[model samples]
Target: MVTAVTDHTDHADHPGDDEGREGSGHARVEDDFVTDRKDVRKKDFDMKDFIKRDTGKKDAGKKDAGKVGVRSESRMFGLVRVEIDDYPEKPASGDDTDGTDGIGNKGRADGAAGADAADAADSGVSWDDGLIARRVSATAEGQARPVKEAVVDSRPPVVTPLAYDGSLRSRLDALRELVGLSRTRLDSRTLAEAGQVLDEATARRRLSGQHTVVAIAGATGSGKSQLFNALAGVAISETGVRRPTTAAPIACSWSDGAASLIDRLGIPGRLRRRPLQSAEAEAQLRGLVLVDLPDHDSAAVQHREQVDRILALVDAVIWVVDPEKYADAVLHERYLRPMAGHAEVTFVVLNQIDRLPGEAADQVLDDLRRLLDEDGIALGEYGEPGATVLSLSALTGDGVPELREVLGHFVAERGAAVRRISADVDAAAARLWPVYANRRQAGLTEEARDEFADRLADAVGATAAGEAAERAWRRNANRACGTPWLRLWRWYQDRREPPTGRLSVRTHADEEATARQRVEQAVRTVAEQAAGGLPTPWAQAVREAAVRGSQGLCEALDELAVRAGAPVGRPPRPGWWPVAVLAQAAMTILQAIGGLWLLGQVVGFMSPNLGVPVLLMVIGIVGGPGVDWACRLAARGPARRYGLEAERRLREAASGCGRARVLDPLASELLRYREVREQYLRVTGVGV
Candidate 1:
């Protein structure tokens, strides 16, 4: 018998479906829905097709049953769950109603069962298909939601390992600052090398923080290549008795993320390898970028050059030596002693110890340590054992684990590059200590500047200008406020010598020539004073800077002398000048009238009015003396005041020229000295 357990309940009418539809409209971003809507429609169509095919099969079974009306009491969610349920035999219409299955069980039951079997065969739907259900969701307005958001498993988050982010940022920042300062200010070639070290370190760190480069440096026949292969646990570098077996540096890294670092070291792609990942013991040595370098003592020039280049960039160095050449003078002179400050990253490997007796090997290692100590190599990390001297034989694999363990520790504990660069910066700072340290904080004192200004003032003829201005001012005053008779007398005398009682500019071609010489001497003296007690080279620099203005000093001074000392027009006439002149005019008019009357009396052209004439004469004569006295009194003070002002104006201009030409340049040198000192203190970490 065909039985269908279908969910006839419309999901659109389900409780909370209205809320779901409303929230879905708002919850899904419009852009996400727009792009994915077509796919959602396709899935919906496929699911609906499955639903229709299922319903058609059931309709055929039911058609056989309306003939046999068969039904079952079972519900499905979103899918039709089909299960055969055996129905009780239906009573014939004329016989018994013993069972109530709602369908007559006469002959239709057999017919419907047969039809259901045929439809099941045609439909080919079975429970074995992994997708046993076609899910349906209701959107707003009775529409189906085709696709549903996938549910993620709720679990604790998996923590990703953190990469190094310059944990020593401040210290490295300080060290880089020191390197930059030393490169610029320190004349010594050592600082340039230190700067190179810093640049390489920072570049490598930035490219990949996880990797620390280790260079296996050795002389001819030192077995460094063999050790490189041994440590990497694979023969990444060829070993031979031939001279300069390694022409270029060969990089063998334990980790996968050091490609950029290897590329920066100039290692070719063909020469790079991940050689130690297979070994469980060596797995802890990740981020160790080991290089087999060309022998430093190679006979080939290019080989030595390659060795020098790689050694400079690597974070740590392992010096490989044999018993036969454990104390080679060339290695000590060229590499070890000079790199003593780098002991934190330096290791002296006494290789080929298998050939020596145990005691003999120990003695050789001890002797190597003593030699390193004498070279001022402080062993260890910041006063701990800096350089590790170990005996390892690559041929026999003796003590290889110890070397590997030490390197692994180094690679694991971060900041080797920072430590190395800091040591180099320290070396650079030490070299510059004498150059910049122990300097005074004093600048050019005010007393010294004033003296320089005074010298400059004399050269520009300031004194002469002032004196001339004083006299010129007095003359101008007299012209405006003096008695008319006295003024006329002075004006007549002016033809011989122009009045000097006003502002005057006195510039001598001869004075300028002499002034130039004085300026040069003064510039030199100021430079010397500013450079006092400084190092010889810096002192010379200061002196040169101060003297640079000397080329144009004389010309500038001459220009200012003509301009500053020249009169700024005549001083405003004192308030009393107009009054005095007016009074003088009146008195002169009275005198003229009185004299004319007397003349008329003498010529007998009119009666001699004796009373009026005598009174006019007396009044005119008395007024003339009084007005003259008043004019003299008023003009004296005005002349003095105007002369002083004119002198001051001229002096001010001359002073400006002197400052620009000489004083300003000298101050620049002083500023330069102060800057160098501060930079030096910062680089050296000096408190002051």
Candidate 2:
């Protein structure tokens, strides 16, 4: 339901204020009320439509929440309220104003009144008649009328949307983290790249805002100071006879904006922020923080350290390498190779070109370009073919103007140093991610494992164990349950009884030969699988590693078996049944002696009734011991001999796989990790 109420306080100013026209004026008021109510209803309808439209198109062009575009709106009011639709809402309380109210006089008035009322309520003010009378009087006098001054809230929007840059920043951040992790795990190039990343990140952060930091990097006696002087248009840095000069960093700046840039660099105000004599002396070079770093090949440890530290934090780098030392291994290995990715921000200067013969200058420049290419540096103008390599003699001021112009243009572009570092870090990280990933290995099929297991079981004398158990059970049963009348019945029962632990013995020859063959086959299959799909060099390495591992396993197993005192050779089959018959005869004679003694004892001299039973017991006990001793003696010789033979066969099998001691896989993996790490570090400008 809609309700309309007109304020009567302004009745005096109405057209029909006279008493005679009260009826018409009242009708007019009702009509105006209806029109206002219709307008409100229309606004409500529009709001609903807006909600539906927004819901329908929600996913049409959704971007990352963090990267919303920043927009600004200017309001006429002193208090400018920035409404951010995407901003998260805060809970409403008596002290805090809820911001969702529709924009109109009523909403504003109610909000303000609510706040004041809440304040009054907290102050223990009573809502009595006296207060009402005072309010009425104040209203009559226009003192209590709501103030309608337009508020201009200049606050920036809560949700400052960033431009949609295709998640480049996030990708870069991930890459940086990866590089950092690689630095911890590996060494060599990867580690160097990681250090470079850190250096760039630091430099970028340092050079952000209005600060300007310029670094001069070059080899010894390369006219760096001369170039520094040319750039500064003054003999600020020592040069000429004092070769390899500028052992320490010398910072130069113009009077204007000099203090600010120096301060940003954390250079103390005490360090002379010297002002140029001419008012327009630093006009072209305003905001330039020129730093003359030590020569790259200088022997001073501190000098090198300073060069490294400043290079990391500088806004721009001027690489001044002379034609002679440009191709030096120390320069390329120590710096160029590692900093190839920073080509965009790097300026390669071929200093002291005046020393070269006129005809040789062009050749040298070409050689420098070729060297840069070999170093993997992208050269030339933006979107052009190669890195920008300029030939200049700092001593002669030749090409200095062109170098200065390039520097000026570069500074004018004012790229984000932090962003660039972030990019480098991201790139380095992307390169190293594969190493940490869980590489999938080709797995053995279930059928293969089962086949191997079956082969192993057969080779280990499974059938022999079964036969031995059956024979042992039969022998024990026959000895325990035998009678003269039931001897044939007992034999039948023995044949029917399941074998226990007596069968044909597993001669060492059989066990060792079978085990050796099975193990060899298993090792060969494993080695083949490991070597498969690898490149030639890697395949050979894998094969060699596998062979070594297998051989070691074989030796270990053989050693363990030998220690267990297993038989090592073939068991003997006696050529004579006479030996067994002789042994039985000896047992019979011992039984007769025992029987005579027992008879003498029983018949007032020996025990007559127990003689035969005593004799049987003696024979049975003696016979079992003799057979057990004979079997052990027969098994010992063959077991020892064959065990060594099995070991030798396994070793031969391992040898067939490949060279058994070429390289340790674990150590090789670690070395590869180090190499990759060093490369990564070099790419990112991270030092070891």
Question: Tens-digit lDDT track for model 1 on 467-549?
Answer: 66666766665565455677778668878887574433343455556888877777777777777877665666667767676
| Model 1 misplaced stretches (Cα beyond 4 Å) | 1-202, 234-236, 273-279, 354-362, 381-385, 393-398, 424-438, 471-507, 530-548, 566-648, 661-688
Cα TM-score per model:
0.57, 0.43
> What's the lDDT of the predicted structure labeled candidate 2?
0.50
Query: Roughly what TM-score does model 1 have, to 2 decimal places?
Result: 0.57
Task: Note the Cα lDDT for every prediction shown.
Answer: 0.62, 0.50
Model 2 C-alpha lDDT per residue in residues 1-688, reported as the tens digit of each score: 1111222111111221111122111111111111222343354334235334544544541332122211222211111111112222122223322222211111222244433343233323332211110011101121222222222232322221112132444444444554554454445675576556655554444333443567778888888878886776544556756545665676666423334344444443222223222233345555566777787788888778877777766666788888788888888877876777677677889987888886788898888888888998888755673346798988888999888777666655555354345546655665555453223433234554445434433444333443443344334333322222245666688899866653434555565776778766765665565444433433455566656665655444455433432234322223333454455445556666766667676677743567465766577557645644564454444444444444444333333322233224523533444454444444444533
